[model samples]
Target: MMCGALYFTPIGRRDSCTPSEFARFENDEQKGSKGGRIHKNKKYGFKFVLLETRKGYSIIVGTWSGIAYQGENHERIESGPMITIRHPLWTKSDPRQDIPIMILTRAQAEIANDLSVSAAPFGPQEFSRNAKFVFALPPRFDYGDSTGTEEVREILRNHPLHPF
Candidate 1:
């Protein structure tokens, strides 16, 4: 199956967040895990929201909400779980398992291996571990792209598309 990679960009050290900000981030993470709504921009399509990474843990929360800035890596990893962490904006259920987890292809996995990037598949039984947050590397994109891909990359790099 065709897949894409979403590169993990560090925003800040978890310890660096103010208490309120950390609380809010934790709250948002919990809500998403409990089936809260993941936001999407109507005009610009989807905003790849910010997911957090802590200093020690290997599991990271994928906000599954937020905006993707221009030129940011926007490839979707295929082997990752597409489990819905949030309720659909207009529906009671979302059947997708691709949004909140990172699944890598064999080739991508090898690339990740070479790059020393970890791509661990959460075991089916561990889905009930009940951890609200975790951290691991998001996939990296390295394959060559077409002209259209370059155009999209250019668009992502340009910031007028950013609302904030």
Candidate 2:
């Protein structure tokens, strides 16, 4: 169980994450919520990608910049990327008890290693074991602003995990 910086987002659906929804998680990197409280991991300066195992997609949370809610007043606070990864646990409604996974680039893996988060380079076998599909965006691409799901699908259609 490695434990370094990771970006996180929520999964509201059953088996997939929309490009737009993923964009928000990818671009938005802040430490707490609207309720205002410091997350234990905030100090670690990590960002995490949130996903559902059922959705069959995994993302690597890289560097991010944005405002986040923190403290008792729910004040808007801006901060650099903080790092962390929550352990995989199935969503309540999903009876399979599947935990979501993350895929990292070489640099991201290094960062995760620094923070003690378990991470490995993106590979087909890793993808096969962790997800049915992958966003697989390179570090240079700003996936948060990407709205073209069809274009992405076209590119990834040949991938073994793609359902289509």
Candidate 3:
């Protein structure tokens, strides 16, 4: 299963795949977890939306503060908020599981918000392509050697893709 698979683009690697390509690959795998639960349970303070693009389907995730509202033909997700959170590195041991961190991007947030509103009137389901939205991945800081920690921090702090 390719669910939650993380793709890393090493520094100075010109052949790295774009986020859109990765999303398409994951979508083609058809191993994505359903977003129904996340959509229904707003108490978690997280919002989810599923989008159908020309490449394939992509899932959008964001928080309430970042998303203003969602609806069919009427959706708005502010592209200004940045979410920094820790995520577990499955390849690592238990105690060090939470080393991986990420900052969500504006494009990703918009996609999530658009998908959420598009499905809101109907239910938790996929909606047709929204020309204004595109699939993207958040910038993730993975666990590496001690020497790379600073580099990761620098990337997390300076990457322009992340929302300000």
Q: What is the C-alpha RMSD of each candidate to the true structure, in Å?
A: 18.0, 17.6, 18.3
lDDT of 1 at 134: 21
Indicate whether candidate 1 or candidate 2 has the larger lDDT. 2
Q: Which lDDT tens digits does candidate 2 get at residues 1-164?
A: 32322333334333344653332232333333432212121222223322222122223233332222233445332222212222123243532322233333444433333342113342212332122222223222323433333433342343323211
lDDT against true structure, model 2:
0.29
Please report, in order, the local distance difference test score of every candidate based on alpha carbons. Answer: 0.27, 0.29, 0.27
Model 2: lDDT of residue 4: 29
Q: Report the CA-based lDDT of candidate 1 relative to the real structure.
A: 0.27
In the predicted model 3, the residue pairs found to clash are 70-117, 71-117
Query: Which parts of model 3 are misplaced by more than 4 Å?
Result: 1-141, 162-164
A best-first ranking of the candidates according to their TM-score comes to: 2, 1, 3
lDDT string for model 3 (21-109, tens) is 32222422232254211112122223222211111322222222223333345434434222222222211232221112122343553
RMSD of candidate 3 to the truth, in angstroms, is 18.3
Quick one: best TM-score, which candidate? 2
Per residue, candidate 1 scores C-alpha lDDT tens digits across 1-164 of: 22222344332223353443222223222222333223323322322232222111122222221121223465333233222122122122421112233333344344343332334232111111111222122332212442233432332243212121
